[model samples]
Target: MKILIDINHPAHVHYFRHFARIMQSYGHETLFVSRNKEMAQRLLALYNIPYMDRGKGRDSRLGKLMYLIYADYQLFKISAAFNPDLYLNFLHPYPSQVAALLGKPSLVFSDTEHASLHHKLTVPFATKVYTPACYKLDLGQKHVRFNSFMELSYLHPNYFTPNPAILDVLGVQPGEKYAIVRFVSWAAAHDFDHTGMSAANKLKAVQTLAGHAKVFITSEGALPTALEKYRISIPVDKMHDAIYYSSLVFGESATMASEAAVLGTPAIFIDNDGRGYTDEEERKYGLVFNFTESNADQLRAIDKAEAILSDKDAPQKYKHLRETLLADCIDTTQFMVNQALQFSTAHPDPVMPVNS
Candidate 1:
């Protein structure tokens, strides 16, 4: 079977990288088409996954609409030639749109419950939409629930192993304690009204957390001069290893927070609207702490981070919690591959591209 996967974000690359390899090992063909957003294209190159560039996305409303049309046309052309048996993505609209035009099924995976605009634009065109069982909103009949977090697709023990060499690279000793702090650019469609930690809070969080443990900031946007020294410079692919070895993670990114939580590192996620998966991680496994972007809540989040850092047994405790989480969840990459193969087998006939 031939499969075409669209990548819109760096995280989407990780979500499907393992799946693509596993599919190929089974003697199937896989094609990746990606937007040159942030590190998306670079990561594809790093992983040696050949992909077609779908152009860098735009930020303005009118520019976004234009890019949407441009991306659809580009993908349509690529799909026409590739003639893939199925389409897959992380809730990206272009694949669903192009797949519909090409008369193929598109399977979309999403764990973000608050991406209403994205859902409105993409869900109607998707063949089936998959989300974690803990997702808050229901997508009616097309909705398929899974028993795992999206981060597990790559971070699961079966797929990922932490490299202690990262410690030497970071100039930290074997037993040193450090924290990974993340900040998002707030540029996505779903992030329209959402806000994360304020500038003052960002400074405060870094300063306070630094006192407790060595701080490393990873921001999508430019960091303030005062905080520049704390910025982390590591290979993009080794980020998971950094998180795995961190004593705590304090950030405005839900994805990073979930990544840290699943890796047995406690994460404090701050945002006005929280993700369903992060909420579940906080409530069920106690590996993540979710906080609103309010002033009071941000302070509380920092306090929680410091408290966790102060505890000598926090790492062991979170490690135990992570084991329970792993035991409860499925290997997401295998599950995704299984779903695609089963879906393709059920609809054995190849979808012929319609004449434009």
Candidate 2:
């Protein structure tokens, strides 16, 4: 089978990389098409996955709409030539629309329930929509719920093992305490009106956490001059390794928080909107703390971080919680591969060509 996978974010690369390789081992052909969003292409290269670049995305509403047309054209041209039997992506619109036009099955995966705009544009054209069982929004008959987090697609023990050499790279001793803090650009359509940590709170959180542990910040946006010195300088692909060894993770990114939580690190997620997966991580596993962008909640989140840092047993406690989480969840990469192969076998018809 020939599959066309679209990547819109760096995380999407991780989401499908393992599945793509395993599919190839089973004698299937896979093609990746990606936008030049932050680290998406760079990561694809790092993983030795060849992909066609669709071009950089736009942040403004008008620009985004225009880019949508441009990206669709680019992908449509590529898909027409490749004649893929299937399409796959992480809640992206371009592949879904193109798949509909070309008459192919597109399997779109999503975990962010609040991405209402993305859902409207992509779900209708998608042949199947997959989401974590914790996802709050319902996407009608096409929706399929999985008993696992997307992070597990790559971070699960079956696929990943943390490297301790990241400690030397971070200039830390084996048992030294440190924190990973993330800040996002907030330019996505879903992040439209939502906010994360305020400038003041960003400083407060870092400063408070620094007192208990060394702090390294990673931001998609520019950091304030005062916080710039703390920006992390590790290779992009090594981030999960860094997170695995960190004492804590405090961030505006639900993905990073989820990554940390699954890696057995305590995470504090600060955003105006909470994700269902993060909510479950907090409620079911006690591995993450979720806070709103409200001033009170932000402060409370910082306090919680400090409290967690003070507890010397935090690592052992969170690791135990992570084992519980692992036991309850499926290996997402395996699940996705099984689903794709099953769907392809059941639908043996060739994909119809795109109309001129």
Candidate 3:
């Protein structure tokens, strides 16, 4: 089978790379399509896969609209030529739109709940929509709920062994403790201004956490001068290693927060947003804390830190829970690939998203 995977962000590359590899391992020809954004190219370059860059335009609304329009046209031209058997990627409208046009069975994977705009653009066209059960989207019949997150499948212990080789790559010793902090540019078109931490707040958080442990900051936007003082020793290229070995993670980026949790690190999501997927993941698996941005005061964080450290059993407990949760869940990549195969076999021509 010929397969194509689309990546809109750097993290998406991490989440989907394993799946693409599995497909290739099974003798399927795989292609990766990516937007020229952030470190997306940097990360995807690690894999030996064919890929194309869908260059982005200005960041403004009109600019993004123009980018999407131009990119979608380009995508259509590419899809017509590649003629993939399966089109898999994040819940992006453009790729799905092209897949619909080319009659290729498409699968969209997303954990985002507040997807009103996503639904308006992509749902009607996708062949299947897979999400964590806790996701808030109303897909009616097309929704396929899973108990696990995309993070757990790829980052879980079964599939992920802490490649200490990664530590060598980052030049970090085995036992050094560090905290990873992430900041999102709420300026993105889809960001919705929901990022609870401002540049000033991030500086303060990094400074306070740095008092206890070495800190590494990863942000979608440039860091402030005060925060940039603690430059990450590990190149942005090897961030996952730093993340995997981190003692703790404090971030507003849901994806990284969940990634840390799956790595069995103490992850704190400091955002005003409450009880979202990360929050639920923390409750279901004991590796994380969802601190409301309002209550993420320094004092509160100190207490949470103390609790995580004081409980000698906490990490072990979360690891146990992660293992158990994973045992009950399907191999997400295999599941996705199998779904694509089945869809293509059942419907030679692309059908509208199931239940649409």
Candidate 2's TM-score: 0.96
lDDT by residue (281-338, candidate 2, tens digit) is: 9999999999998999999999999999999999899999999999899889887887
- Candidate 2 wrongly placed segments (more than 4 Å): 346-356
How close is each model in CA RMSD to the real structure? Answer: 4.8, 4.8, 4.4
Q: Supply candidate 2's per-residue lDDT for 271.
A: 85
Q: What is the lDDT of residue 142 in candidate 2?
A: 97
- The CA lDDT of each predicted structure is 0.91, 0.92, 0.70
For each candidate in turn, the TM-score is: 0.96, 0.96, 0.87
TM-score for candidate 3, residues paired by index: 0.87
Model 3 lDDT at residue 299: 43
Candidate 1: the clashing residue pairs are none
Worst 10 residues of 1 by lDDT: 347-356
Q: After superposition, how far is residue 158 of candidate 3 from its true place, in Å?
A: 4.2
Model 1 error, position 321 (Å): 0.4
Task: Output the better candidate (1/2) by lDDT.
Answer: 2
